[model samples]
Target: MGSSLLPEEFEQAALGLKSGETRRFEISLPADHPDAQLAGKAIQYILTLKKVEQPRYPDIDADFAVSLGIDGGDLERMRAEIKENLERETQRCIRLLLQRQVMDCLLECAALDAPRTLVEQDQRRLAEIARQNMEKQGARNHNAPISAEMFKERAERRIKLGLICAELIQQHDLQAQPEQVRAAVETLSKSYQAPQEIVRWYYADTQRLAEVEAEVAERNIIDFVLSKAKVEQQPMSFEALAKASQSLFTICDKRPEAKEGPPER
Candidate 1:
């Protein structure tokens, strides 16, 4: 785990224990942790060791490619596809980070009080989406753990930013370019069964076109904020970007999965 992922005084801590040994310790979290609910909390952590062994991965051969149903068992094409997917994901992360930066600037400049009705509506909508996502992930809970009240702060911020974006779009006469809209449609339709048909569907409906227009308008606002703000350039390695975006879900992974595994022999 990276330093950011580990609690203070836990990173690279010595755990001098043989295989099959167990240890328990206390973890202290900082007040400004990403999970605000867990801030300043003390957690008891237990480490247990099962049989530790190094991981063995299969070779990158035609049989592997054929099993994955890609490039007709061509290794080079498989590599190319993997690279393309990674680059696309990295580009998405860059856009999200840029959006956050722009939002922070805009929020600092504007004083906003989101309408109570809109905020309540947004809170309900967000709660519903969370419930749906949890259900999709095979959660068997009859009721969602999150309440609409839990979404109030986020909903208020979201509505306020939306109002600001709408004002910026109207005051500046911002229009979504046709080419940009088409590009967006193309990007969104790539994963569908029939991409061309999906593209046509987006263009065929005026309501959908308005949705796309709003997306482009929001992007324009981001660009406008970036242009006005004092921006600094920092070069980042591809490895760093990938690491920054990596998610480790301990959902049925190995006990000593690549971390405190078998001693090197």
Candidate 2:
């Protein structure tokens, strides 16, 4: 958005030029200028103004604070709460990064065959989840057909990782402490309005507690792996940690094969 009719020096410099005022400047384009072929060119320019406008912003007052869910319009309290929330998020991301690294390392080291039956069971489970998602979206083809092989590889990977975690848990005699489970439950319910009721709902169900315990056990396995593995302390910022892709486990087949290895479809 430049005017060719006016020289570049005038430059539409409106920020300094106030309302109801006009000014002019001149510029000489050198021979090396992009538009100049061989010789320099001189030109003159004029400036004109119609009006000036300044942006209007709402003041950071009580009303503004209340709109943002801050209580009593205490800006200091808001800052403290924001800082605490960001710290929690940073901790969560660090855990995710460590867990991802541990899982990938264990998957590469653990050599185990994925059972066909277990893989098939997980395939059905994943397929059911997909159908349920479609139903939630109010789709007519909620139970639409899908390729059976679609979830096979993913199921196999998940099953293999589960098997490895199970083995590690038994070998290490790892226990998901009651306090850890309670902490997990509290973290899960913190964002809800009725956090106590949410916590009660989880505590009332033994099956749900068992699920949390299983997750804790897996996390303990990650900790155990980190303890013995050659450790390196690399510092990372919260933004980097949050933006990182928390990768799940995968394995590459380096198995010896006859003839040629075919590309997977």
Candidate 3:
């Protein structure tokens, strides 16, 4: 087992222990240790080696294909499905990369001061969003203070982009049409199971519909910007692009499965 913190002496003493062996040691925690309860304290720790288990993987054969519940136990079909999933994921990553590039280009070309009021409001919103994300990831410190200052630069950038997008939208009449919003929702829904149901779910609520409309409008802005901007197309492998997007992309709970278009809601 590996630990973030261990006194060298304690580790050395425990190194020779076999299964079912036990050892006791004490060490002083650093003053600024992250765990408040253990900080600046001498603590005794008992190490025990439980029975070790080795991982065993089954061989990929007819039985393995059957175990995966592939229709007709066909390995070729499974492989094709996996390829389809990979291609879909690759396309999603490419879309995100394009959006990021478009935003970066806009930031470089446009010059405008971010309004203080909007920046502050966005800072608060960003701070809250960060806190919520941390909570969702099982962070224990609910009371931990998240400073809005940490998001000031991001908020300012967002404000500037919003202002620029607004101006462009107004000047070019780039507002999302009803059909465009519906198409966007349907396209997004196709990635999930029972996609027609998902489409209906989106249209059932006005707020949900509005969210899709807003996203469609933003996508229109990206398309308009790309039309005007000089873009360099760089070829990259799916694996490399997926790796590059890891930091920026937040994986949703559900993996995309449905490939066919959903019935219109």
Candidate 4:
């Protein structure tokens, strides 16, 4: 009976039985049943028995191995893959911890009040970015919908950081010059196949050029902060550094716009 019905239909049938409704069952085996595989076959059993019970999975072993499309030998490879994934996750967590510590310290030292407008703008920008990312991945974010209140909180934090960073930049006089911008463009070009085309495109629009310059200026600020910071030069692996940078950037990416006021006291 279960074999002939969909999962939903099976559940409904079970529910009907529980509700004291009469349900007739007809059972017959097909001609292919004798030759069918039994290792992971779905078997349908029917009887005039008054009670129907939910099935429970058995303990895993050699039989379970056949169900997972892997033999005992293949299990080792899966274990190795799981170990690698765990290591990566651990490294990522460590990086996030470090980045959070750094940001929290900076925020404490550089206390600033963010503008409502700037916070709203940053929240909107974040939502737009998330939507675009979902679109690019060909996936819809049905589970995590964006809300204005949530955005407001995120935007506030971002705006505060932006104000702090902007203040730092001004205090240090860290501006990206034309030569620095050109050098940055050249460095970026090396990553593309058509270097000249990329360079041309970057220089073609004044706004685009300014955006690149701003990025360079931000990097300069990061470098300057590292210089002034009492960093304990921990000898981390390349993977650790990559993970740390990713975590650091994730926070930096959400920095808020500067408010229209003097830097926070």
Clash totals in order:
0, 0, 0, 2
In candidate 1, which residue ranges exceed 4 Å CA deviation? 1-53, 131-141, 144-146, 189-213, 243-265
TM-score of 2: 0.65
* Candidate 1 weakest ten by summed lDDT: 249-258
Ranking by TM-score: 3, 1, 2, 4
lDDT tens readout by residue for model 3, 204-257: 888778766867787788789888877788999876787666544211101112
Model 3 weakest lDDT span, ten residues long = 249-258
lDDT: the better of candidates 1 and 4? 1
Question: What are the C-alpha RMSDs, in order, of all predicted structures?
Answer: 9.5, 17.8, 9.1, 18.7
lDDT tens digits by residue: candidate 4, 90-155: 655554555555556677887578888887777777666555555666876634655555455556
Q: What is the lDDT of residue 87 in candidate 3?
A: 85
lDDT of each: 0.66, 0.66, 0.71, 0.60
lDDT-wise, the better of 1 and 3 is 3
> What value of lDDT does candidate 3 attain over all alpha carbons?
0.71
| TM-score result, candidate 4 | 0.52
Error of 4 at 237 (Å): 1.3
* Regions of candidate 2 where Cα sits further than 4 Å from its true position: 1-60, 192-194, 246-265
